[model samples]
Target: MFLILIKLAWRNILRNKRRTIIASIAISIGLAALIFGDAFMIGMMENLIKTATDSFIGDAQIHQQEFRDTREVSMTIQELDEVGANLAKEANVQYFTRRTFAPGMIASSANRSAINLVGVQPSTEKLLSQIDDAIIGGGFFEKANEHDIVIGSKLAEILEVALGDKVVVTVVQAKSGDYFEDWFRVSGIYYFADAAMNSGMAFVRLKKAQQMLAIGPNVHEIAIKFTSTEYGQDKQVPFWKTYSQHGNEALSWTEILPQLPKVFAMSEYSKYIMGIVLFGVVIFGIINTLFMSLYERMFEFGVLRAVGTRSFGMARIVLFEAGALAVVSILLGAILGFVLTTIFANIGIDYTGNEMMGVTVQEFIYPVLTIEQFTVYPLAVFIFTIVAGLYPAWHVAKMSPVDAMRRSF
Candidate 1:
């Protein structure tokens, strides 16, 4: 019986090809809009997180509880070796590195500026951060030389220095709390394309920074990169319990970069809001089209009913027509969406100089089409399309055959 209704519905839809085409186009466009919007938002979020994490924070970090608040060289992680051993035991940990940081001054013959001097282990840091990839000229340190340093391109431009040029870095000693200065030759100039990082930070050998700061075998931070960023939030509790003790704490990217979660959440919520607004427009289009189609058939509906066609059957025909339209439209929309997403995902959308929420994206963003995007969005539109047809279908069923037959178009 339902098959017969569907056949009748299809025949009726074919009678008004223009109306059906118009309605189908509306639904198809809506579906495509949703898919594209979701993909774009997801891509932006992924890029933001990757740039923020790989550029500096990594997936997590371990620091003295007061280190974040005070940014003092003396608040160092004293048990670096033990903490490393514990981190090694975690299955999710992919790479880890020790770093010491201080706010200091860098001076050259032509210029001077305050900078964040970071001391890093070159070998481990290569795996944990993008500092290696950020090198636009010269080379990353092959070995820990006390005099070698990597400065950001912006900093280099400011100090009027290039690779092999000497720049003096000055920092306060941890022991005496007195300032000390040393000269480092620029081995590399890196461009992360972030104004703040590029202009205000420099990297040197870990041992050299330790010596300069007068702290023996101690690091202010231990940055870690996990096998997957997805596991970072889940692993934090256990990692903290295992590694953090008195005066120390372990933090996930979300914690260390508090703005990240807010930006991510806001981006996602904005997509939903846009989707709802788009769907509202689609709903009205569907309702208007379906109503016009049904009204045009009022005389035919009356003739069918007068000839003993059940009102229930009349209603079924209208609903079946809507369902058929939705199915056809959604399928075509999905195909279009797949083609667009695949093309863009491969090529990527580059916004090299643009900053989102203060995080600079130094690379291209690749849109991701998740399983939920393919399934949930189409399903929701399909259900809503059917619901939109319900009132029109009910109107047709309520018609008195005699009155409907006499009613003019």
Candidate 2:
């Protein structure tokens, strides 16, 4: 019986070729808009997250309890190896390394600037951060290399320093001694996502920093990378709990950068608003098309009823027609949207406006395609399209067979 209904519905839709074409186009437009919008939003979010994590924070960080709470270097963890060993046992842990960050002044022959200097173990640093890949010129620090520094692109520009240029760094040591000073030859220049990070950050070998600052092996924090970022809060929370139990504190990327969640939240809310507006516009277009088709077929409906066809039967035919059109249109739209998004994902849209919040983003925007957006969005659109035809079906069912048949143009 259902198969027969579907067949009848298919034939009836074909009988009015123009009307079917218009309805299908309306549904297709709606579905395509939703799919594209979702893809673009998700893609942008992924890019932003990647940039932030790569430039500074890793997926997670471990720190001394007091250093985290007070931002004091004096309370740094001396037990680095013990902490690294414990973290290595975790299934999701990919790379772990210790780092010390200090505020210092850097000067070259032409320019001088205040910057944040980061001390890192070269091999472990490469495993935990994007610094190695981000180096645009020269080369990363080698374990055997001493008194060598890597500066951000902006910093290099400001300092007018090139690869092998000598620069002086002066920092206040933690031991309450007089200021410590050292000269380093620049070996690399890197460009990160944020202009501020590039302009105000420098990297040096951990041993060099330790010797210059008169500090021992104590490190301010331990940065970690995970096998998969998708594990996110679930993996980090348990690890933090375990570490806290052993007298240390653990923090996730989200905690290290508190502003990220707020940014993502705002973007998500904007997406919802855009989705609602698009959904309404599409629904209105579809409903208008369906209603017009119903009115044009009133005479045929009257003839059917006058010949003993039940009102429920008429409603069923209209609904089946709506469902069939929806399915066909949604499938077509989804295929087109997926193809377009995949193409754009590789090409990306570019923007060259003023920097936002210290980050100078590239001009290109990329769309990200996810299985949920491709499959679920089309299904939602199809269901909405079918529902939009309900009122028209109900109106057709309410007309009296005698009045409908007696009507003349």
Candidate 3:
């Protein structure tokens, strides 16, 4: 009986070629939109994370417990050699670099602006962040000890300085509280999408910055990059615990920027909201198609009822017809979604220099395709299509032979 119903449903849809094609096209569009939308959101979020991390921020950071809270120059990481040894042995750690920081003033001939002075190893810092790539004018530190300095373009305009121009750096010694000042020729100027970084930060070699601050062989911070971002995102991993000893604190980017996870959660809620809106709109179209088919066959249905065809069998055939239509839609939609996503994944969409959620977008975003897009969305469309068939099936089944025949021409 089930096989006979399936055969009848297939034949019934085939009888009206134009109606079947139109219904299938409408449902296919819905499924395709869902699949492509999911991929696009995933890509966007992933790109945001990459931008936030790679723009002078590593996947994770380590510091003395109070350095984060106070930004004090005195809170240097202890037992540096042992910490370096452990990091070298850790498989998940791809790159780590020593850094020192101080609050200081950069004085040009015309103006003086507050600065967050950073010390970094030139080679390792290049591998860890996009600082080298961000140099729009001048150049990055050619050698770690070259007395070269890098400042942002915004800060340059504020101070009225240009490449090779001389400037004075002023900071207090950590132990003596005595003011120390030095002159440096600006060798590089970098530009970042974030306004904060542009106007308030400067970078010099670790050797020179440490000398300026009078903290010999001691670093205030250790920046770390993991082999994969997933490792750094998991805060509970043993690598963090192992190195987070001896007055040091290890933190993933999530802990460092607490609001990022909240933004990610909100993005997920948007996906469900979009899905509901789409399903609600497409459902009406499905019902309209089913009703038109039912009314067109009213005379035939009345004939079937007069011959003692059961109500359950008539309802099952209509539901099967819905499934058939859904199957065709799912196939076409899946193919279309796959092709579009794959193309974008390769060519990418440029959103460079655009800022979002407090981070600058440094590169292009590519749609990220997943197996669930094909499976979950198609399954949802099939189920929703079957549910949509119910009202039309009920309306047809409950009609008496006389009423159905009278309504038909």
Clash number for each model: 0, 5, 0
lDDT of 3 at 93: 90
Model 1 spans > 4 angstroms off: 235-237, 308-312, 407-409
Residue 52 shift from truth in candidate 2, angstroms: 2.5
Write the residue-wise lDDT of candidate 1 on 264-305 in tens digits.
888788887887788788888888988888788788889888
lDDT of 3 at 327: 88
Off by over 4 Å in 3: 143-145, 407-409
**TM-scores for every candidate against the unseen true structure:** 0.95, 0.89, 0.93
Candidate 2, which ten residues in sequence have the lowest lDDT sum?
351-360
- Tell me the deviation in Å of residue 68 in model 1: 0.9
Tens-place lDDT digits, model 3, residues 53-130: 777778998888978999888889988889988898988999988999999999999899999999998889998988
Whose TM-score is higher: candidate 1's or candidate 3's? 1
Best by TM-score: 1
Candidate 2 runs further than 4 Å off: 66-70, 235-237, 245-247, 262-269, 349-366
lDDT of each: 0.87, 0.78, 0.86
* lDDT of predicted model 3: 0.86
Tens digits of per-residue lDDT, candidate 2, 1-409, equal 6898899778877878887787777777767777788898777666666655654678888777767667654666656777777887989888888888777999999999999888898888887778888799988985367888999998998999999999999987886856889999999888776666778889999888877666688788888888877655464357777666455778777777667767778877887777667777777776787677777777888988888878888788788878888887887788878888889998986643335433355346689888888678777876777787787778777878877777753
* Model 1 RMSD, rounded to 1 decimal: 2.0
